[model samples]
Target: MIDGERDLIREMARLTHSPLGHAELVYPWGQGVLSGVSGPRKWQREVLEAIGEHLTGSATRHRPCRIARASGHGIGKSALIAMVVKWALDTCVDTRIILTANTESQLLTKTGPEIAKWANLSITSDWFTATATALSSTRKGHERSWRADLVTWSTSNTEAFAGLHNMGKRIVLVFDEASGINAKVWEVALGALTDADTEIIFLAFGNPTQSTGTFRGLFGKQRDLWNTAQIDSRTVEGTNKAYLGELVATYGLDSDLVRVRVLGQFPSASSMQFIERAVVSAARTREPAPALGTDPVIFGVDCARFGDDHSTLAIRCGRDARSRPWKRWHHMDSMTLAGDIAVEAGRWKPDAIFVDAGNIGAAVIDRLRQLLPDILVSEVWFGSTRVREANWNAGGSGGTRIRVANKRAEMWTNMRHWLESGCIPDHQGLEDDLTGPEYGFDAEQAVMLEKKDHMKARGLASPDDGDALACTFAEPVQPRAVPGWLDPERYGRQRGGSEEGGLYRDLGNG
Candidate 1:
């Protein structure tokens, strides 16, 4: 190598011990002024220190260096991430780096360009060639081994993250806008950390836009597993003070948006989450209390039409609801599911059975009618108009008036009300499904439940259990009374002074 190449390699080796060394060498930071751009913010220096410790000073070998940062707008998170990427490439030989963002547009438009801009200004700029998806080392000996690739990940295609093993070499993985990346991608990325001796660094930087998932968990359940940081824009120098003031004025300092954008805090509730976990937990713990003066025995069915999704059956008797687990049958015929429902309805003798008739549900309804001639079966199409007369008033002079965008929305709203006032069997799947979808208001200002497609895109499984429970609200039904001839006391005696046992038997314990 020539004298210049030799000097470059020497400096790179010296900077390997500290990210601060690499940053000082590349940027012209003299006195208090930063040349070319504004000086590095305090938060940026802190991030560099954390990365430096993980890369070189970490005492343990078993745990890889994991840094998760949640920051507000204009905190220069992207610029800091770019600096780390360049530092890793220059300091570590034979290194492999992968950069990703929440979406392809974000990766291409924002993250990719920011990295390229910084790479152009670095002292060793001539050593690499920047492309749209990759930055390749142009040096004679390290052309192939030293490079960083930008890979956009998605739920449908995860192959980009597979087979990322670089034992005995440095590996840097950076996730920008990390909150929007699905949990599945995070799981896939874990496979890359298998190399025991690899100098590995995992950096996740994003705004606290999502309250649930891997990014949020870093500050919660997985706090001990990561070196976490929260950077508020207002605390940092060079941020737009006017913009921050306007936001605080419009949405209050304590609002969710302000908490996320200014205070660098996760919202108390997820932006789109419809139901709260605390409410669900309370419902599960409370004792069963059926509604007075009403039988209120209702059955709800959500049919499965495609791929791994389950056909679920939920039964509610007054305020007490049976725990109905979702059942999946691969390529099962419609008539078979109908037969199963018919048997359940016959035993429970529900006041009403509401079946979601959007897809293959019509066939199930037909077969159900044939099997139980006296059954009160209703075909409920979710896309149909929401029946306004079915609105339920929980209590008080002005109850939580439920008005939804469509039938599906109305049913879900009713299900939420049920969870608040009634009792449900303790089940994890049911809880997850119940709290899955987020809600919004349509043009008409009615509550609109998010589409299933959106939920699937976010790596959430089909909420069949929740949907089945919601179907029970398709229409209101008065409880069927016992025959006038049968004495109330005698009927109670036959059922052991309570009808709960018979109710359980009617719904089938399973």
Candidate 2:
């Protein structure tokens, strides 16, 4: 080797425990690949400094250096990941680094390319060979031992993560888009931390897309075990301020979209959760507006199919869902539930009654139709794939509509939208029912809710009450015209409606 090259290697080795120093000294800023770029951003510098501190302490302790960062989009996380990978491999001899992401595409297309870019820009670039899937030392005997591999994590195939052991040397594990990584992968990777007297650095970086996951736990339950940071895109320099402003204006500052994409905050619900707990809590405490006397009163009935499930009846009048208390019955036959629904319909004189037409619900709907011939009793199949044209505007871009997978998804989405201004009774069971089901996108990218069976398998009860409430949104209901003889001021009192005067009297008294 040349004398200058040997001097460069010795200088890099001196910065073994100083990641921040290594990053600043090794990379060429404002030249070649990094033209016009000055240095690391403020947050990146802080993270690198934290890593340096952790490594300094590793000499005295056996604990792994755990660092997790949850940040908004477009804040240059890929660049930071590349710097860390380069620093770990270049300074420490026989260092083994495992780089993985939420998906193979992210690892190959985004992260892998970024690492190569930075490695090529580094002063010690000639010491290593970079490839699409791996980077290895070019030294004659250290090719296999001193390396970093880009691995695509899989729940079923966790051998790569399980075999991450390098005794008496450095082991750096990086998880990009960590929020979307499976919990099983995280568990399997923990096995690598048992190598005592070794320098272990574990880094996780991702947008906080999910509320319930290993990533969330790193900031919450397991926070003491790690050094964590949440970086808002707005606070960091070089982010597109105009685009972020547009997002806040479009989705509102507190919306989940803004919270996840701009503020680096976990959503009020999981990313897969259709309804957020914050929205539900707000609805429960909100004061309902006075229902117009002409507003239609609707009844939604969800019949129980199994012995464990409960039959539920939910009543709503315009914004006043809390005016009437919900009715629930366990171990009720379809015939008996139908009879009870018929009696409620007769007493309340609901403008429309929507009944679930799945399994035993079909029998209940049949009995209700026969008993209440004059009333508008309609059958709604939960699995039906038809969505009202007006309800397709929940989420989309460029005027495109977001399609829902089935009638149940449509109803629940409609109910979620309504909760913005509507009022609901504050009940824990109803809260559980509303927030139990997680959502996913189908093959065609249509929004689909988790089936009740899936929720049960996850140890959550069937959302019968939530389904009954959502059933009210099955179809639009026109307001009923007021009688000509009744005075507007005294109409509610005469009909035994709300205390403040509205449609459908508060049924809590009854």
How well is each residue in 432-463 modelled by candidate 1, as lDDT tens digits?
A: 77877888987777888888888877767778
* Winning candidate number (lDDT): 2
User: In model 1, what lDDT does residue 112 have?
Assistant: 88
lDDT for residue 52 in candidate 1, whole number 0-100: 72
Q: For each candidate, give its TM-score against the true structure.
A: 0.72, 0.61
Off by over 4 Å in 2: 1-3, 58-61, 270-272, 279-436, 440-510
In terms of lDDT, the poorest run of 10 residues in model 2 is 501-510
lDDT of 2 by residue, 382-495 (tens): 898765322433345523345788888889888887887789998867876887689998887788999998776544678999999999999888767654334354544554
Pairs that collide in candidate 2 are 497-505
Error of 2 at 398 (Å): 34
Which window of 10 residues has the lowest lDDT sum in candidate 1?
A: 501-510
- In order, what lDDT does every prediction score? 0.79, 0.85
